[model samples]
Target: MISSDAYILGKIKEGDGNAFSLLMEKYYSVLFKYGLHITKDTDLIDDCVQDVFISLWQIRHKADSIQFIRQYLLTALKRRIIRVETQRKKTLDLHDYEFDLQFSIEDILAERQVAEDNASRLRHILDQLTSRQKEVIYLVYYLQLDHAQVAEIMHISRQSVYNLLSETIRKMKDFWENAR
Candidate 1:
């Protein structure tokens, strides 16, 4: 049996509007949040995400080889955002923009006094990481994507994903230990 994602892709390739709607409903917010980490412009993010879906629908028949819809969508969205940002560079100083990953303690922690402190500490450590490291950590742990999926989404080698994840974990561990 085809997995739900594959089934959705198949339906989409067959021009099933409902399947495309389901795909959008499933991934729009995720793409938006990921886009936020890449660029601070909300309008750009919205437009890029919309473009990704529209492009996907247009190329659905050619997307039969896609095994992971989320990874494919994320990769396309990231490329779209980067392309838009590059175009904007003609008018704006690129240095003014930063690809910072915004994390919220409330998103990661339960409502407990002790957990709040731990969450804050973790957030600080996360903020200390390089943008690429933070992106790897977010994709792997927060999004629950495997190294292969992360590698695909980030357009990096699987080995690079492993290295980034391991180094980020090592840094976080050292910070946690030193804090104790």
Candidate 2:
């Protein structure tokens, strides 16, 4: 049986260093990618991820039970990135950032020629979406997170999450239909 994040967190609270290491390894890449979407600076993103983990270790005993570790780490990473950028007098609008997520169907396809054209077209359509729309899609679809989790991570209401997702899907459908 796989151990849950909540269980690992409990062990960390008990001063288990191995549990802390496991937590860091599990979330580091996901958190780093999320931070990259918020800030273009690689060093800044890396630093913020490290800071989040360090802070988590320091506050393990006082931290409340975390039902969703990915959401929790993402929220922390976003906050850390924002706080750091704010201190440097950078613009604070969430939509002001760029998203660099890459989607490739070739990785999933055994025969490259079979899906090459479709993948290219899909990539082009995805590139047409606004940064906010892409971010919402990435979190909700690629990350497989629910509306509530995405809302908390994005600092938006649940209704906003639904609205954004709806609009994104509608736009994609329209684009795809027109393309066909």
| Worst ten in a row by lDDT for model 1 | 90-99
lDDT for each residue of candidate 1 in 2-51, tens digit (9 for 90 to 100): 79988888888899999999999999999999889888899999999999
lDDT of 2 by residue, 109-163 (tens): 3354435566566677667776667778889888899989999988888998888
Error of 1 at 36 (Å): 0.9
Off by over 4 Å in 1: 88-98, 104-124, 175-180
Supply the TM-score for candidate 2.
0.80
Give the TM-score (vs. native) of candidate 1: 0.81
In model 2, the worst 10-residue window by lDDT is 105-114
Each candidate's root-mean-square deviation in Å? Answer: 3.9, 3.5
State in Å the error of residue 120, model 2: 7.8
Top-TM-score structure, candidate number = 1
